[model samples]
Target: MIDKILNIKELNYASSLNGDNLKQKIEDLFERPAISFFGNFTSQTEFAAYDKLSVISWYVPNFKRKSAYLKGEILKSGKGTLIKLNIRPNTMLSVASIVSVLVGIIILIAAGSSTRFLIVGSFFILVGILYYSFGIFSRNRLRTNFEKTLDLHKV
Candidate 1:
């Protein structure tokens, strides 16, 4: 429900690689870490199966939280393969930010005549906007990375 509102990006691509080959290629891009708790801060792709691909940036320590995951599905087509991709915002993060803003607004409404409440509530809204904006920016960056790595023409 929240994901539907958080600007999901979708695209179609024409890939020459078959399902198995495409899976292998995307698998090569995933982090092969040995005894690592926190995964790569940089964006990387992983395959849940031959038909599914996930792009993630885990534990990226920064002001802008990387909160978007690129999810994709591969289908075998007559020519080669078709890739359907979606950049989805993190559900947990989105819900938390929205709830935080809502709580702030509720506080302001309850304290009808308080200027302090107004300031605090406005700050919450501002923070929520900033956080969501970073997620949007990260979405674009992830899209670019996926397109480049796949090297597929848009269909």
Candidate 2:
């Protein structure tokens, strides 16, 4: 589900394609079909992010990890173009992880004579931390990727 639709003002696609073609190209570039399309000069996508702002949406291969869905639109303006995007995070997994850690803590507190409970709780805590760390790692990776995708200004 889309959570936040970002507004990108005065964007320059530097392309000559008509509105429909340009919208299709944008969706194709994102690899996700858009959910809606507007007037002769407007279109909307259910999932798309600027190559930079979408850093947090990157996916990692793990059962604990989750996917983020996005939605937005592109419209022709006076000189450039206007873009509106909604980025949503699959926070259920993270919330579940937090719950797991809490469960683990409770198990430990009540696991007086059971090593199994202690181990299980510890495992939950470790997994929670690891999954959370992966999110951070992916976001940092996005930053680097974004920079590489853009030409650096000459000093």
Candidate 3:
């Protein structure tokens, strides 16, 4: 699958809780639909984006949207419940950003020798790099939060 090839961020945890208890813990960690910044989930395992605004790290979400959505799978094992989590990026958002940057570059090329177009194109390239860099930088933070919330021990 693409997930395996892309090296998506995955966390596997062995929880002592039974299936229902594990599910409940995950459910409890999510904010109410009205309070959530992202869409509500009806799936058995998927949760909302990591949108808990913290005074200590208030700006994390802005750059994090590219890679903060949560997807998970719960499997019953003989020893315990297994929680498989994927910290997936917002695909649509990522694609849109790329498309926009490409458009900006194209416009700059079409504008020929204009200094203004060059400046704007450079800004677009800088913004794109910053956006991707910050997303990658925050992925570990999101993983840590999931571990703390679920009391996960890495497997």
lDDT values, one for every candidate = 0.61, 0.45, 0.62
- Which sections of candidate 1 miss by over 4 Å? 31-66
Better of 1 and 2 by lDDT: 1
**lDDT of candidate 3 over 1-155, digit per residue (tens):** 65532335777889999988877866666644543223334576555555343213334544543345666778898898888877754453344446657867886887799998888887776666555554454555567767776678877
Looking at candidate 1, the ten consecutive residues that score lowest on lDDT are 35-44
Winner by TM-score between candidate 2 and candidate 1: 1
lDDT order, best first, reads: 3, 1, 2
* Cα lDDT tens digits for candidate 1, 66-106: 35566677778798888777775555455566777787788
List candidate 2 stretches off by more than 4 Å: 1-24, 30-66, 75-79, 112-115, 134-155
lDDT of 2 by residue, 70-151 (tens): 3445556664444443333345435555676787788889889899988988898887666555444443343333223332
lDDT measured at residue 36 in model 1 versus the true structure, 0 to 100 = 14
RMSD of 2: 9.6
Using Cα atoms with residue i matched to residue i, what is each candidate's TM-score against the true structure? 0.66, 0.45, 0.60
Using lDDT as the measure, which candidate wins?
Answer: 3
